[model samples]
Target: MNGILFEKMRFTCQQSGHCCCDPNIIVTLTYRDLLRLFTTLYCDFRLLLQKISFYTLDSTTSPILEKQMVLETILTSDGKVIPGLKKHSKKICVFYSRPSCSIYSSRPLACRNYPLAFVKEKELIMSTWVKNSPKTCPGIGKGSPLSQKNIEQRGKRFFKEIEKHNQVVRELNVEASNNRPLTAREALWTLIIYGESEYQQRQK
Candidate 1:
């Protein structure tokens, strides 16, 4: 590990509003989420999850609806009724009301873990959030240090949830198209798993 990596990871945020404009955010949801979101739309949970269209729940359509994330979006029209990523706006986070999350209570799992994100891979990769070149976030490095144990605990839960979510996605993708299914590695991490080294080195 680099000696500098253990320097307490200091950052001071000015919150000049730059973090709100990132264009490449991906939001991933679970099969359970698909149901949860549909309930929000249809106002009913007893209906089958497939009752909603997969396209509308996609990242492109619902970018800012919940949290800012990067994940595959379904290619259907009626999928929009589900609680998927809110479409990105010229605005920062759709929930960013001047300075805080508007949907704080129902905010997506990603929002609760801001400034920290997991990368998908054979082994999990963790990455620190770097809000572009000109943005500043007050919580970037000012909170109490999160121990590796703490992060791992969260990671365990996160992975389990994502696994179930991935399973659901695979099923949906298969049902949606008769084409070949995506590899587990590809579907699960979606390329975010390559950052584990950075996460481990910083753990000390």
Candidate 2:
């Protein structure tokens, strides 16, 4: 994770909704993201499913891109899957309602940390602008200086959720390789159940 110090950077969301409306950007999910959506949408799996889209890699996909996706995304019988927010016919995010995200309060971590990506290195955390952020993103250099401590706090939480989600995916992949592959739907349901259980345990 090669990146600059968070203390040197500045950002303020202009709330233009460009990230949500950009067709080229894919809002990938962690289990915690799905869980938040699940709870926000009344715990209805059907409704949750409607908001997600499974991206499958095929022979036409470039080997390098495919390799990256396999390393970072989910796997299902359908293909190497990257479950993300579904786009409408016009290619905007499904949750995009006019000027903002309809579910902004419970939006995924990826969305919450847009324009900036963070990773821990040795004894420090590094921050960088996301590679896929829109060129016209209005929030890049326009706001007050960012707080290093706050950035670190958010980064810690972001990576923690990602680690837990990756663990679940690894377990599912092992099960799939053992001759009991899961369909995309089954894989998502597993995540939902696992997330729900974790949420319940946390309440105790």
Candidate 3:
């Protein structure tokens, strides 16, 4: 936990089911997150969760959509879109149980860092609890101050993993554009099964 910040933030989860029950809260899954789920669920992302696609016009892609994120997309009036997750009928997360998260241990990064966000600038990753965390969450400012070092480490690892993930996705996106465009499921399978020599060889 080598960092410049010395102050700690108090937060202890009460498990009141606020975050999990909220319909508006979208849990964005990363490549690693999906891999963890695949391993946990016996390689069944198709059955347990839905594959949401997000499209964006980027320079690296040719007359096509390319983005690392694959949550439900929010299309703007002007045709702009931002991807996010799809909630259940009540806006509850897909994995939310009655009083707790079904996959609490393997929850996505967004769930793990709920009410708090981290941003990376150069080599420094900074964290800040959301202003509304205390309003809706009972855990904030209630327990021992959270170690800033721990938060920094989590943030660092998140960014590091995502960067590696995006690199692989970008390659796939380019390949899809030049050849035949792959379905969302295909793209997701590529991400979930990335790094294997089989996928690489097939791509080549």
Candidate 4:
């Protein structure tokens, strides 16, 4: 119930674009994600910045509010918070284009592993998905079983990149806790441009 539960699973995209336009799913961005997007779009960081917006957790209701990472949170004058991607005014993905994803080639790991989430526990990776997601995803149970080897490879790469990205996020979180919260501009610089050099320096 908490996370996914599967050593291996079956899934295939129906190309319905339901996942891309899912009203409930908010695609969170990572350091690698931003870098890839900037590269793929041949755009500058400032332009990409306009696409991201913050999604804060409700401290009042969230029991583990303090447990949230800095990258997830916005250090507003009010409180710390978790940030996420901004959506179109119609509550759809910014890159969603009616029948397909605008940037499907370089989609984020989260998008890549849709309907097949990996939950790494200690030395294992457990995969899982919504029980009845086929209501919208016609490809579910319609194709041959998904290849475990390939899925593992993708999951491994995703977690590896995630660890590296979270390293920077944790550093920013520390600054927030120490009363040195990064300003909006500084946060954007660190999120979009700087990777781990600043955090690495703090260690030395």
Question: Which candidate achieves the best TM-score against the true structure?
Answer: 2
Model 1 clash tally? 25
True-vs-predicted CA distance for residue 159, candidate 4, Å: 1.7
> Residue-pair clashes per candidate, as listed?
25, 0, 3, 6
Candidates, ranked, lDDT:
2, 4, 3, 1
Off by over 4 Å in 3: 1-8, 49-85, 195-204
User: What is the per-residue lDDT of model 2 for residues 1-75, given as tens digits with 9 covering 90 to 100?
Assistant: 468777777888999988888877888888888889989999999999999999877778888887554125566
In terms of lDDT, the poorest run of 10 residues in model 1 is: 187-196
The Cα error of candidate 3 at residue 36, in Å, is 1.2
- lDDT of model 3 at residue 22? 67
Pairs in steric clash, model 3: 9-146, 23-91, 72-84
Candidate 3 local lDDT, 1-204, one digit each (tens): 323342566778899989877654556666666666666667776653463434344445543333324332222222323333456778776677788887778777677777776666788787776545667888877777778778878888777766766666667656765777565555556667764443468689
Instruction: Judging by TM-score, tell me the better candidate of 1 and 3.
Output: 3
Instruction: List model 4 lDDT by residue over 54-166, tens digit each.
Output: 66556475656445332345464335534455678878888888788888997876788776666677967656674446466666666667676776787788778777667
lDDT of 1 by residue, 26-56 (tens): 3345543433343344534334222222223
Candidate 3 minimal-lDDT segment of 10 residues: 72-81
Off by over 4 Å in 4: 1-8, 64-83, 130-135, 196-204
Per-candidate TM-score against the hidden true structure: 0.52, 0.92, 0.73, 0.79
**77: Cα error in model 2, Å:** 1.8
